[model samples]
Target: MSLFSTPFDPARDTALVTGAGNGIGRAIAQALVGEGVRTVFADISAERVSAAIGASKRPELAVPWVGDLAELDACDALLATADAALGGITHFVHSASPPRREADHALAVDRRIWQQMHAVNLDAGFHLARELAKRLIAAKRPGSFLFLTSLHAGTPRNLPHYSTAKAAMAMLVKELAKTFGRHDIRVNALVPGAIAAGGVRRGSRAGAAHSARASRRGQ
Candidate 1:
C-alpha cells in the first residue's frame, strides 16, 4: 500500500477551499494540492491568495480566487469563477470568516460587525454549499463538503456574533447532511480549539497572557 493515502482520487477530484489565504483554510488547501487534487484557493486578499498558491506543494494545481464572501454578489462571482476554472468542485471546504476583533464582544459589537460575521460564516457558506450540491446532483456525481465551525458553537466565547454564527453553522451541517446524503453529497463540520494561527484573537489581557504562557509551553 502507498505510505500516504486518501479517499480522494487525484485524477477525479477538484476542490474549492474558502479563506484559503491563511491559517486552517490555507493548510487544508495546501494539503489537498499535495495530494494531487486541483484546488481553488479562495480568499478575500489577492496577496494572501498568491502567497498561499506559491507555498503549496503543487502550485500548478492551485487556482487562486480573491473576493469578499460577505457580499452575496461576490459569493456568486466566486462560484462562477471556480466553475469556469474547475469544471465541477468535488470537494468543498468553507473556512472563510471575518477576523475576530477583541473589542467586538457582545456588548460592544456594532450591527455591521454582527451582520458581516453572519454573512461570511453562515450565509455565504450555505449559498456555496447548496449551489455546489445542486451541480453535483444534476451531474449525478458524488461530492463532499466540510464546514469549519468552532467549539464556541456550544459555549460562549464572549464573542456572541462569532459564537452564534458557528452555532447556526453546526445545525446547518446536520440539516444539509440529512438532506444531501441521499444525493451522495456529504456535509460535515469540523470544530477546532485554540491554536496559534490566523483568525485567532485575544479577547482580553488575561487571555493574551494565557496564550503567551501556552505558547511558551508549546501547547
Candidate 2:
C-alpha cells in the first residue's frame, strides 16, 4: 500500500455537500459516493435533489436534503436531518451559492442581494463548519471541511458582493484550518476554473456575463 494513502475511508464516513443538487457540488457528491462514502445532497430545489441522486453512481448512498443555506434556520434543519438520518457527518463541502446574476453589479446590487450572497457563501459556511467542528471535537472524531471559493476573490470583478463574499470565505478557510488542526479536523478551499457546471452552464448567460467581466478587466 502507498504510504500516502488518504485516511478518508468512505465506508465509515458520511459527507454533507451543499449545492449538491447540481454543478460542482453535485460532481463532488457523486465522487464521494463512488468512493463508498454515504453523502447528503443538500440543495434548495427538491427536483434538483432528486435529479442529483438519480445521476449518482451509487444512489443508495446518496440522501436528498432540500434546504436554503442562506437562511440560518435551514442550516439548523439540515444539521438535524443529517444527524437523524446518517447518525453523524464527518465530511462537509460548502458549495451552495446564489446564482451570479448579470444584473448584480457593484452599484446595481441591492442590500438583499448582498445579504443573500453573504448568508449562503460566508455566514452559512462559518456556522455549518463551526458547528460540525464542535461536534467532532466533543466526540473526539476527525472530520474535514471544504469550501468552494472563486477566482474573483483575490481580484476585482466589478461584482463587489460576490467577490467580497468569496474573499471572506477564503480567509474563513484559513481560520478554520488553523483552529481545528489540533483536533485532526481538516479545512480547505477548492477554487475552480470556469467549469461547465449547473450554476454556469455552457454557453449560458451567466457564463457570458462572467466572460464579459473578465474581458473588461483584461484577464
Tens digit of per-residue lDDT, candidate 2, span 40-137: 99999999899988988889998899988888999999999888888889999999988776567887989998999999999999999998889899
**Candidate achieving the largest lDDT:** 1
Q: Which regions of candidate 2 fall more than 4 Å away from where they truly are?
A: 1-8, 198-219
lDDT string for model 1 (1-219, tens) is 322555568878999999999889999999899888899999999999999999887899999999999999998998998899898899999999998877788889999999999999999999999999999999999999999999999999889999999999999999999999999998999999976564756578887787787778755
Q: Pick the candidate with the highest TM-score.
A: 1
Q: Scored by CA lDDT, what does every candidate get?
A: 0.91, 0.87
- List, in order, the clash count of every candidate structure: 0, 0
The residue pairs found clashing in candidate 1 are none
Error at 201, model 2, angstroms:
9.2
Name the regions of candidate 1 deviating beyond 4 angstroms: 1-4, 202-219
